[model samples]
Target: MESGKKGGSMESEKKMLESNSILETIPRDLVLEILVPLASSSLSDICNTKRSCKTLNELGNNSYVLRYVSLEGVEVVQWEPSPELLSFLPRCEESGNPEALYRRGMVEYFCNNKHEDALKFLERATNLGHEEAAYVLGIILLCNKDESKEWGIELLNKVEKRKRSRNIGLSELRNKCKAIVRKIWLNNVVCPEEPLCSTLACKNNKRKRGQGWDLSDEDEQVMFDCKACKWDHERTLFHNMLCGSA
Candidate 1:
């Protein structure tokens, strides 16, 4: 019985070694494509892969893997990124990882008050097709001059198209935006000072008011047809989305 058990264990070990060898023989870029998604979704798999062998360990530790590694695990490192991440974030940002860019942009915008630089990072993330980045960028643009309103609405409308398609947690995103903005001085900037959209006297409150994020077609149509109300509805929605969630 003991001999049989030992023989089984050795077979397993040999199979594992052969698999590792096969993995090493594959092209580096191909391996990276497989590993990046794994790292992004499963924290455990990549950690074990890194521990299994030298070639993989080196690959897992390098820029390609680091670029898209799960941001969820490192979310705590975002606002108060550790000493190492201060240096590491630039590499991830330079590699064009949307999540990394979004995180670093938040730190720069909210924590460091580096508005121009932060906007650049957020813009890069949005251009890379990061929807959450687009949502936040839309709100930020809305907070700026009136000239920014058109582009702001354009970006937001793009995201709103996808808002209901997947289980992307648009509501949760709204709450998060409200929470982050409320923590800083930008809280009031999001809400227009006019009467609440909840009230009939709201600047652009036409036939009826639109709900926070759930405006019906007719309600939205009314809000948009009247420019004051459109801006009102949008600003109010943003304001309420931020303040409402906060």
Candidate 2:
């Protein structure tokens, strides 16, 4: 019975050694690379893995990993940013992580409509070579009637050049930018008048009256009336410019 117990212990020791060897063989960078695509929930499981691998634990808490998981994972579900993810944003911002900045800008813009914060983060991300951030910020600037329009056009042009050279990922964003640019050029030809709610009083009047125009009827009238307002096209562009395809 003692011999049997000793044999069992020896086997367990061998198994433990083998597991440690396997863990050690997997490079930390490779582990981090694999973890980048995983969701926060998966990373939680990895952190709970029955091993004392400090690298694995570190990867689970890495700012870049948290940002990627939050942007790709929870953002799709229309949920608030996870606490674990939000906790890393400051670190990422301090580190000047472009992707993290972009994600934070998106959260602020979409969730809170805090345009100033969104623009600040997005501009930093863009300056740091984040193409998506540049594209988004450019579009936002394009929609505004301010000095930023020139900067917006410049940013879009830069992105266009980059896309032509690389042309991978961000296909939807590229298409949207193309459509927006084309629409901007078309504006010169169409000379569409500004919507009635451009002014504060007009907006307040609109609020009291509720959605002042019938876009569908106006759109139908455009076919017959050469002078009909391009309300449908303007409305569509307005929505797309602000909301984005995210």
Candidate 3:
């Protein structure tokens, strides 16, 4: 058991180092700037990359990155309405990368309501230490039609256990997940049969309302009707100009 634990730790450390080395070859500050706003799930890849080298150790050591990512994780775990924060999400899916795959799953599961496949990717992610995966797992267990809060809490507790050793707590995480679930569920229950009252309002703003007659349309009609009149007027003006010249 001791050798197994030590071997696992060493392997993880080595993997962290190798990943960090690749990132170290590049400038650190630039990477941080590009990474700061990225969603937590995506950031995990960056962290993993940073862990591969000693020179990149500082990248992993950044408390700001950790805090931001943690807050994001909390929001997702709790199911907060975080449309704005989602700007950090990667525009394209990095499905080939396991970490990216999991992040994509989380975004789909919560924000976009693609729950079926979310479970598959998230399960794979949890095996790889993607904290967000654990959060989702807890939620699924708790909220599944046949499941109970007890099972959900157990999953959450497992996450907390991992966090406690790492000095991260599940309290905030649990709260965030619960909050998100509440918002989504409430939205479902109260959501309109057709659409929200806001949809028409949104559409109204999108469509430029004609103040009276659309000036462009009126101008077109006038142009057609006045074709003969305009031609006659031009002819008379030209004749008068010729007469005056003569």
Candidate 4:
């Protein structure tokens, strides 16, 4: 049995080596298609793949790989990176990577208070099919200027229908966004007054808004029907959350 196990392991190794040899013969562009996903999945894996052979090493460090590099567990996303590290983000942005745009947008918007720049980055990210970027962009729109509310709601509704994003649930995404808001807006974040629902049921019931409720959640949405009030409640709700404990 031990000998059989050793034989199987050797067979697997041989097959892997054969595959590697075959991969080296493929067109560089085709190899890049494989490299891009590897970069997006894990930077470490890309490095390992590059180190495994000379051919991969030559192709791995190009613009193609940097454009789709994953930032999921990268240090920059968790905190402000130093100046030397700053250039990395722009390099990734030059490739139009959605994750890079979203990360850079979050920092610029919340930390640097560069709303316009952040929005541009986020909009690009959303255009690239980033679900989280869409959610964050939608929330920012809803709570900000009046002209963008409709567009904000449209983006959010798209987010609401999706069950999973970046391997996290909808609730997790809400919590993540709220956590960032809480850390940044540590004071009273509420609007001056409730946007007030015009419908009779909303007026009579007056389900108080901004008490840590998710705007698009079914349970919360069921509590109010007026579109105006619902948006208002959600807008204030985000504000309240932003002001709440981190």
Candidate 5:
């Protein structure tokens, strides 16, 4: 009777070992697919599991899994791409993944301030029909005050048209872009020289010309161009009224 009981115990242990081995042998991609839909909290628990659950923890590090969690608004540690994700970036870019390109552009723009690199990646993503990427690129271009402003406006208009055609609600990002464009159009005042003034009064002052007015307080009199009292009166008015001085 004792020998038969020991034999049964050995058989159960062997089956358990086989089951664990099978779980370890499952493909990584399949594991990731299964884990992607799990809640971030649950995923965090899995990552914190015992050393014996190393396979489960490793699946938590998969790029697709991490990206899905990010999209779900989960605050994963090192929420940005890890070395593993960076390693797969080239492959994803070659595969024409718009999200990958967008992510790369955002990292360059926000982290490194590499506008050119960000523009290159974001442009590629936008060309591939990534609306969010287009919105971001458009805003960046609009703020640049260079040749890119036209292209930025063009992209923003395209996005607006697409949204209208699809009957989609307007996004806050689109609204912000529209507001910026409107502000630029409404305030189309020009500065005469490189050293621009901060206030609208200074910018619109007709008496000011070529950079700024030269003010002097010699003999308790303010002077603009040393042309007698006319210059002094104008300078004093500018200093006392516009500049808020006594």
Candidate 6:
């Protein structure tokens, strides 16, 4: 029985070797075509296999392939958003990867709303010269009520200046994102009046309007005299004027 088990295991190993040899004989383009069909079909295995070869890796990373997987409703994290995807980002940064840095900043930004943590990654990416990172960092800082708004403005200004100098087209998404951040910041931080004081002032105004009385000493005195006259119509009107509710 042990000998039979050994023979079966050897046979399985031989079959695997033959299969691998057959795959190696196929042309590169044919390999990509085959893998493309299977990319969304078995995403986990595709990722594992893609990591093992440069040509296959490129095919997997192709924007076309990515779009297909995305449209097929493959979960982003499974088919595309794996941490190993960061490997491509560093290459982007090396090649003046503004987009890559922006994505990295976004990942950290959305991971948590921790401005301090996002700032560290964003600042580094910007300093290393990622223009999009600068722009995104600006928006993040702008939304962060606790952060230095002045710095946020400066970063945004820098992005504009850099874009003009580099002749990069205006990124509509970045601009829109920044505008959203500004609107939200205004709503939450800068726009509203001081709550306690505004509320108190509003209540005071409402009281005055409702009661039809000014909160002045003269108004108080008149109210006192009127109440006094109503309570004692028999007493001297002069006494009523002198004391309240006689």
Ranked candidates, highest TM-score first: 4, 1, 2, 5, 6, 3
Residues 68-92, model 6: lDDT tens digits:
2312232212234656544544544
**In model 1, where do residues sit more than 4 Å from their true spots?**
1-22, 76-84, 164-172, 179-203, 206-231, 240-246
TM-scores of the candidates are: 0.67, 0.49, 0.33, 0.69, 0.41, 0.34
How far residue 41's Cα lies from its native spot in candidate 4, in Å, is 2.1
Best by the lDDT measure: 4
Per residue, candidate 1 scores C-alpha lDDT tens digits across 1-246 of 999999999998787788789987899899888889898887678879887766687788678787777766555235576776676667778888888888767666756768889889989999989877787777777667567756777887778668646635345565565555554444233444543234455534545443343542324233344444554445556665655433
Clashing pairs in 5: none
lDDT (10s digit) by residue, model 4, range 180-240: 5544533323342434354555552355544554444534324445556655655555555
Candidate 2 CA-lDDT value: 0.56
Candidate 4 structure, TM-score to reference: 0.69
Prediction 3 global C-alpha lDDT? 0.48
Candidate 3: where are CA atoms >4 Å away? 1-99, 147-154, 172-246
Pairs with steric clashes in candidate 2: none
Q: Candidates ranked by lDDT, best first?
A: 4, 1, 2, 5, 3, 6
Candidate closest to the true structure, highest TM-score: 4
On the 0 to 100 scale, the lDDT of residue 59 in model 5 is 62
Model 2 ranges off by over 4 Å: 1-52, 59-71, 76-83, 167-171, 174-246
- Predicted structure 6, TM vs. truth: 0.34
Residue 33 in model 5: lDDT: 72
Candidates 1 and 6, the one with greater TM-score: 1
